[model samples]
Target: MTASNDIDALAAMLLVRELESALSAREDCGFQLLSSGQEAVAVGVAAALLAQDQLLCSGRSIAPALARGLDPGRVMAELIGRASGPCLGRGGRGHLSQPSAGFFGAHAVVAGNLSIAAGVALALQARLDRSIAVCLFGDGACGAGALHETMNIAALWQLPLLLVCDNNLYSVSTPRAAALAPQRLSDLAAPFGIKACTVDGMDVRSVRGAAVALTDHVRSGGGPAFLECVSRRFASHSTSARETRGQQELAADRELDPITRLEKALLLEGALSTQTALGLREQVRARVTAACAFAEASPLPVPDEAFADVG
Candidate 1:
């Protein structure tokens, strides 16, 4: 997770540009979404994950999914309900995943993937291996009873699971303060004797550092660890939701634009030159373009797939 100066800057720049392009495509589909605002939460946490580690993400994290190696064209296609998509156009943007990239999936249901992450961990345990499951959810999901049950099981079994709560302070317009009694999402882990920490979700490096530490802790046979990343949503909750509320404006957003913040840090730290950053950004854009072309040219699922994949 500790990248050298050049690598870190390269990763930050590439991911930021990819996110920008993906969100643009999503918007072109007539869906004014809220992913650009939460870029840092994904960039930071995803930077810490190894390519082999699995991501059990929530619906709010399209940006993060792209960082974790999902194809932008396919994702955008999925968002627009196109045939060329990761889930074969079956799962839309909110349900997108690329398992080969270790992105398991994201569910629309609140806290739905918590137990599934635990199950993935259990499967790893059955193999007697040490791979980890990283679950990213919202602070609102912490209020769900499933989170509580999953916490107890994760702690009791000492599963290698890193539970990340993206505490963006809103559950589709109902603010975090209004829904949850606990001010901090990490606090929910204490009852299960799980180690927990809170990171500035808006800072990719900070989030990466915290995730690496937590990953190490879990790999060392420790129980579950909780990390609460306080982030912000720039647009409305969804394409339809934003159109309803007219976009909730918040002063908090101006403080932390994840892409800009990371770029500034790279420049301040002298990690990369403006030209080098620009080149990397172009490379990301090119890659995404190619991916989209590949996906568009790919064949669709046979009509028999429904019967084929059914258990």
Candidate 2:
């Protein structure tokens, strides 16, 4: 039940580097740029999960997908619409999943994964398993009907689900304060009668602490809990969207970048050294490069293969 501090640090660094590589690739391909900011929320929340836990991500959850064990090259390939990528390049960057790593999948429709996560949790409950479901979505998703319904159902049934609201402040260009009436997203779950708590989304350790407690509750059959991770997205909406003007306006929010924060924590605690940090960065870069090469060298999905898995 202890937090995997080592894995958390590794995941944060790896996600950031891979994101940088993806952005560089997009830039070369004449795209505007993939998002640059938002590393803390995804990596922080993901670091809280057990290897056996399930994740339901949103379009912006590339970091979590990578940390959960998806190959960076395959992720990049998906972004570029290559046939060798996950979903055979059909799902694209946002709609991602790595079942082998317990990542259920992501949804394009806002709040679409909430209900799916509930279903997964319900199934796990029926099986009498201790595994919990982790549902991630943006602050914008909190306004959706799925959020309301899923919260009610999960709490009413006492399903073991952790609803992580990556409250990045903006749902596309509209800030949460302007679009949502209740700025505090955690309040929504209160009506559903579930335990809800908010955390400093920018700090992985804080997120890890909250996740540990919440997962423990779920393991003991304590229904569900909602965690609103209030973080910021450093990148634009995607690699092609240049209209994203929030990052500039949100510069004040970057006072605590998760990657830097974690590195400092590791260094101060003497858990790792500067040389080790550099080596880790290099290792991540090499792994990302290798993944890209793997995707490029792998054969593209065949033209007739589209219907092979659709029942």
Q: Each prediction's Cα lDDT score?
A: 0.74, 0.74
How many Å off is the CA of 176 in candidate 1? Answer: 0.4
Query: What is the TM-score of each predicted model, taking all chains together?
Result: 0.87, 0.89
The alpha-carbon deviation from the true structure for residue 131 of candidate 1, after best TM-score superposition, in angstroms, is 0.4
RMSD of each: 3.0, 2.7
What is candidate 1's TM-score against the reference? 0.87
Where in model 2 is the C-alpha error above 4 Å?
1-11, 27-36, 244-250
Candidate 2 lDDT over residue span 194-284, tens digit each:
8889999877777777878888888789999999988876665655555466455657655666777777777787887899888878777
Tens-place lDDT per residue, model 1, 61-97, is 5776776867677776676556788887667766888
Superposed on all Cα atoms, model 1 deviates from the true structure by an RMSD in Å of 3.0
**Model 1 residue 194 lDDT score:** 96
- At residue 95, give the lDDT of candidate 1: 84
